[model samples]
Target: MKRIAPAAERNKDPILEVLRPLLRDGATVLEIASGSGQHVIHFASVLPAVTFQPTDVDADARRSIEAYRAETGAKNILPSLALDAASDTWPVHSADAVVCINMIHISPWSCCEGLFRGAARILPAGGALFLYGPYRFFGVFTAPSNEAFDASLKAQNPAWGVRDTDQLLALAAETGFAHEETVPMPANNHCLVFRRL
Candidate 1:
């Protein structure tokens, strides 16, 4: 059965708006941590010219992704791949761009580092890596809601909490990426864009 994530449904349109200008027609967009697969289905539906490769570490999530793909009849969506951001090796070797939404804060810091490393290895010069989620700026949470959310996340797992933008920038710099832009989104979230150098 296809799983529905309410958050994904609410944020999909806003994310697509930011992605429209960044993604070129016929580009292959690799989506990391495609939970519930709702976002990929919506994005593939609107951006038919672009192909979407949705991936998740969880087998159940992959099944939900496949279910959504079959139900939507979205021809541009490829089969979901088993991918773990913390792993050194990835299933796919390359992509035109990488889209990772709401993964940084929920996973361990090592996973975020691995994500940057993997993206650096796979992306060509000028390739894009888009990230969306709540983040701390200068070691401070952007909003009170995000602060509370961070606390909740840490309570669940000490390693998981909102990441600092400065730290992420430094990681990106070390990985040969340049920070392109940061667009604030609804619910005190942000969309950060980076370009491979």
Candidate 2:
């Protein structure tokens, strides 16, 4: 069986552009909500020195990750693990960096809170948490498409909508992460990088 992440095709290169400079040689990165495992396998293929440990809560996704890893023969891509963003217990305790893409808006806001809390506990001082997704800023939507997307997401789940960058920063602050940089990407999405303070 085969699987794929819909956004991986469009966003991986852009995400990598931001990640390449930030990623240190031989650093361990824990990828959250690794749907289809496409990102992990693609990234690991390019960055053999950097170890990528992919995690997803879904069993089917885990199987897809394994399938991709096996097909790619990428050693730097570690076996996928089950990780629930809202759960107190995570599969791994520490990582040099954490990457999550397109998760916050699809799930309840508490998941973001939990993600930051877990990052606080696991990230060493100066370690980074990189989040990629569409977001609002200053109570304003960045794009009309984003506004429509937010409306659709809310229709699906009231608690799920594009988060405000300021709100997210505040939440990260509560979890001991200081804002580092905000990069603009294609499709009105933003890449927020925060360092453990």
lDDT of each: 0.95, 0.91
Q: Give the per-residue lDDT of model 1 (tens digit) for 97-167.
A: 99999999999999999999999989989999999999999999888989999999999999999999999
Weakest 10 consecutive residues of candidate 2 by summed lDDT: 1-10
lDDT per residue as tens, model 2, 1-197: 55976788889999999988878998999999998888888788888899999999889999999999889889898899999998889989999999999999999988899899988889899999999999999989999999999999999999999999989989988889999999999989999999998
Estimate candidate 1's RMSD in Å: 0.6
Show the lowest summed lDDT stretch of 10 residues, model 1. Answer: 1-10
Best by lDDT: 1
For each candidate in turn, the TM-score is: 0.99, 0.98
